[model samples]
Target: MRTFYLLSLLLFALASCQQPAQYISNEGYIYGTIYHVTYESPQGKDLQPEIEAVMMELNQSMSTFDSTSTISKVNKNEPTELDELFITIFKQAQKISELTDGAFDITVAPMVNVWGFGFKNKEQVTPQLIDSLKQLVGYQKVHLENGQLMKDHPNTMLDASAIAKGFACDMVADYLYSQGCKNLMAEIGGEVVAKGKNAKGNYWSIGISKPDDNEFFTQQKLKAIVELQDRALATSGNYRNFYVEDGIKYAHTIDPKTGYPVQHSLLSTTVLADNCMTADAYATAFMVSGLEKSIAIAEADPEIDVYFIYSDPNGNYQTYVSPGFKKLLKKEYE
Candidate 1:
């Protein structure tokens, strides 16, 4: 799925109207793009070092790129003490996995590797191979013991790529706020968490991309736009990672229950919630659940608002929004 990084230029424009003293700079990396956090405070420079320090700690604590990360230890079945940050994120992931009926599994790493999305052999997988790989997929195989983690089964790896980035953004945002940043925007791999007002003194406006066959117009399609203060938004779509074989498209997102890539017609789903982790995980879960069930789940939860784009069996494209989501859409788009 493609996640977008957006800089609030409108906030900058508005800040200029109020004073000549405010400055903003963004920093972070997601999908080869530098995901940034725009900081606007009267004393911005003093906080830069502190922000950098927190970012460093976060990278060390959670980064999959680091072979020594807490998640890596858990996946390797090595004994390790759980940091508070790791515990918080792991709990949230586990809760979502259960709530979604294993639809949002963190232990999908093996499947991702077998499908050639990770550092695997990078070969086309056969049905027999997929079946074997599916045997290793399940949330139940992962366990959290007394202050430690244990992988109950062999080859059951953890891939927190789905929600960890967003969780990281939330943690960073919380840190920024603690550092006296009243107006800030944190984005990691297109998942965003906005706090306080933008430079314009209005909520941050984020553009949700359209699922288009042409990559050039993905951003231009602008399925929906949202303005947020103290909220996080995450979008999941099949357009970003997929392979075609025999005229069939196989997306990177795998269903843990079936151990195969989902074959839903929905192109994208965006979720807005109080935290990026929830939004991030739910976006993936809803995408796998397809249109009807996604809507049903969103309706059942007042905290979640979802926007979905699907292709009808007749080849017509349609968009569906939950009641909670309609308020966030631009009037024209709604």
Candidate 2:
């Protein structure tokens, strides 16, 4: 009887170890893709609904693409007490702006519009127009006053596209954790953040797509496959959202200081950090900085690792990776 009782207890323990349920939340079909969140579940149906609510709030809060967004309001007003979500994103934007030395300014919206990359009606902007736009593209002119956002100059719009999606991903991850989710992965566009493991009890495997000539699919070649346990990853590439005029290819990522597209040899940059916002912002900063300077930046900051792909003057593709990034590469592909 004692042996049978012990066996029963062992079986119970095994049964209790069964995998948790899984749920997926997806929202916002903008910029040509869908943002999604996946979490361990058996959670109430309200789980997805709540996650969607957070995403909706973020879209309403941070989208400069929308005329009704909080950023739009702040740009049009002298002082506005932004919602906590907008405030959080604004703080991160300021930090990144300082770090990149204005290479990644949120106030580059005017340039973005002038270059026809934004919601503004597309038009061919001349060098004179670009020069005028640069005058308004400085983070120093924008200030956060007692949690109230204020822009010193009028007609100076703020575009949080560089960091807002990643912020949304982080917010979704935090919300999932609050709902007792032990594991979750949230991806807003290409910006991704993962917590805990998948249903298989293994880390989530994320693939970095190689920038190839074909825009339809990421090159079959894998740049890096990371096993994310509790981290975020973001990639910025010129392959998407680019237009070639008179043999010069112009990408959407504009240099805030130059008021023009970055004409560097760097093709793409991928960053891995503790949060999606940092990863997203750093990726764009590194992309703008090009290869050598970006490597120096990554080496100086141990908290972030970067991978850069560049084209030589001869148009040959070459890749350079930071020391910290080497640690994250799965051995089989490394």
Candidate 3:
């Protein structure tokens, strides 16, 4: 009788250990964009609230649109103490700016605002305006002292929208990881961090949309798809976000060097890095650097992989995929 009782307990323990893993997804709107996070949970728990809490914290720190946000106060030159999020991202931005030769400057906020893509109202842009804004657009003009951001010019502003969404994705991934999620994917807007195998025991998949412009800005066609494992991806493109005025087009991506919107054939740049923040910054830098310069820089960095989509002189789409990035493709993108 004792032996039979012991055998029953052992069998029950084995059954409990063999429980199948389930995928739990939590999705909502934050940062003015849709965020989706899915994780493999053996406990079948949804961590939407916790995930949202992290996003809210980030917004409170760096959302320029929110008057009460920390960044808003800084942009206004108000006497406000910088938060850790601001310090970290600000330093990261500086590093990327230096690495990209000032192509990824957060101090381009003044230029961005004048171009009508920032928090301020759009104005009639002119060469004189661009030249004036150039004075306040270099990353070297700002420094952090005692948790305070000191600018060379009082009007010099900072904008981290290029990297904030990607960092938010990283933050959510970090939270999920702390909660014991090994296999998961986190995406904000289009920036993503994917690690481990997915619910179906395969690496996560990310899609790159076709470079098309429209009012709604929906995902119309897939230019390509990539399988990602233990890595992050970020894409920057002007195709979906631009305005035409006076028979000329102006994209949101501003060149800090020239204080003008970039006029480049490089339609989209997708970068894969160890973290979403790095990928995001590099992707935007590539957009500002244009094709040849971006190619040279991308080749020099072994930690980054890139896939560039540009337009040929004849208006046909052309693609350039790096060797490392080529390995991640599910199949050749025709």
Candidate 4:
């Protein structure tokens, strides 16, 4: 009887030492892009409905395409009380606009729409049209008073497309954390917020897509791969959304100050920050600031890490990595 009892205890200990549960991956469409989330937890639960609830709520608050969205009402100059998400994004956008000296502006929707990149149809773009739209494109002209957004000009609309996706990624990650998840990766579009460890029991791996307009979704080549744990990553590039007319290439990334798509060699910029929202806004700002100015700004801010890929004078690709960004790279493309 003693030998049998000892054998039973040994077998129970072996069963208790079994491997942990595998990671669960959930993916779907949101905000006009694909979103992917993966998490590992000891307790199994299907959190898709909860995650989609968060996404739909955010969309109702910020989606310009949705006529019933809070942002749409504000855009139409309707007297709408801004939601917490809209207010938070607006406040952050104002700060980024000030920091980048108008390189990042939510009030550039008129220019964006005129360029055929927004909700409105494309118009006959000319110097006069650009100059006229420039009158409506200043962040200082908009303010929030008692939860209401006030605009100096009736047409000075707000568009949060630049930062909304990143904010969504952060929101989803926050929800996962609140649910007792210690390891997870949340990505919306290309913006990502990675926390804890991945399925491999290591830092989450993120890939930076190469700045190629022709093979954006088809080839999908990665320029670099980095381990991002407890970090948010965002990338901005002008190659994908663009049109060519009269031998001139017009990209969707417009300069808020100039009221025209930027004509710079800076192809793409990737930024890493504690939050995806900031990273997303800065990525767009850096694209406007160009490579040299962007490097200067990133160098001054110790918390910001950046990786830049630009076209050199010889038309060949060249890369610039911030001192901190270089440390994150696990693989670098030649």
Model 2 TM: 0.86
Clashing pairs in 3: none
Regions more than 4 Å wrong, model 1: 1-23, 28-33, 46-49, 118-124, 216-220, 331-334
Model 3 lowest lDDT segment of ten: 114-123
Query: Which pairs clash (backbone N, Cα, C closer than 3 Å) in model 4?
Result: none
In order, the Cα lDDT scores of the candidates are: 0.77, 0.78, 0.89, 0.88
Off by over 4 Å in 4: 1-22, 118-123, 214-217, 245-248
RMSD of 1: 10.0
Estimated TM-score for each candidate: 0.86, 0.86, 0.90, 0.90
How do the residues 1-334 of candidate 3 rate in per-residue lDDT, one tens digit apiece? 9999999999999988774767998888998889889998766677888899999999999998899999999989999988988888998899889889999998888887786744234568788888888888899999998888898999988889999998999999998889889999999999999989887889999998878665344647888999998999999998777777697666778889997778878999999999999999999999999999999999999999999999889878899999999999986455
Q: Candidate 1 vs candidate 3: which has greater TM-score? A: 3
Query: Cα miss at 173, model 4 (Å)?
Result: 0.1
Question: Model 1, 1-334: lDDT tens per residue?
Answer: 1222234666667776763336476675543456778867655454556556666676666677778988777677777788987888778889888878788998888777776653244467677887887777788877778887776676788877788778877877888778667788888778999988777788788888767667743445766787776789999998666767699776767787776778878888899899999999999998778788778777877888888888888867688877667776664352
Full candidate order by lDDT, most accurate first = 3, 4, 2, 1
